[model samples]
Target: MRLKKRISPHSLRHSYATHCIEAGVNLADLQHFLGHQSILTTTRYTHLTQSNTDSAIVRINALMDSIHVDWGNVK
Candidate 1:
């Protein structure tokens, strides 16, 4: 009787690592949590996290609004 499925455990572990990265957890912390021998292994999960594009856009907009530059007369 086969009690376990044929799915590979590596895939599940990859999913878990990716989820942790996306949740704002640091790579070092995740590395420890995943029991990886090297931090480089944990870094592979960084690609799963957002590229901070939203945060960068928000900051850029805020800066544009806050700046008081007079572009009309200034050369």
Candidate 2:
């Protein structure tokens, strides 16, 4: 049997980590699941969390609102 695409064990591990982070799994629990000696290793998935993206969007919108720029006035 042959495969068209190459898939590595690490790819599955990475996917698990990403999904767990996005699903709001506890950091400590994730750390245990991944068998990492340090929590820092699991922290890499923090950037993939939906909450982080949502919070960033909220902050950007708030900043834009605070600026109150008038696009119509610009020539």
Candidate 3:
């Protein structure tokens, strides 16, 4: 798996963080996952796109629905 293109550790870390954000992972959890003392640092690593944001919102809504809690009303 050798190629002319070289990938840096920062690139991998940034990609992982971005994917996690796209997967609807909580930012605070991501911060801890990345071992960043400051959440701002974690934010620096993650790049958010509109599509990823929409998907994350959908996933979060689905999760909330699954928990039977919507606006403090239990279903």
Best prediction by TM-score: 3
- What is candidate 2's CA lDDT for residue 29? 97
lDDT of 2 by residue, 1-75 (tens): 998877899767887887787677899999999899999998874554567689679989997777654775622
- State in Å the error of residue 32, model 3: 0.4
**TM-score of each prediction:** 0.55, 0.56, 0.62
Candidate 2 local Cα displacement, residue 7, angstroms: 1.5
lDDT of 3 by residue, 1-75 (tens): 678877899889998998898787999999999999999999998776898878789989999778876699888
Better of 2 and 3 by lDDT: 3
The 0-to-1 C-alpha lDDT of every candidate, in the order given, reads 0.74, 0.79, 0.89
Which TM-score value belongs to model 1?
A: 0.55
Per-prediction CA RMSD (Å): 5.9, 6.9, 6.1
- Where does candidate 1 stray beyond 4 Å? 1-6, 49-75
Instruction: Name the candidate that leads on lDDT.
Output: 3
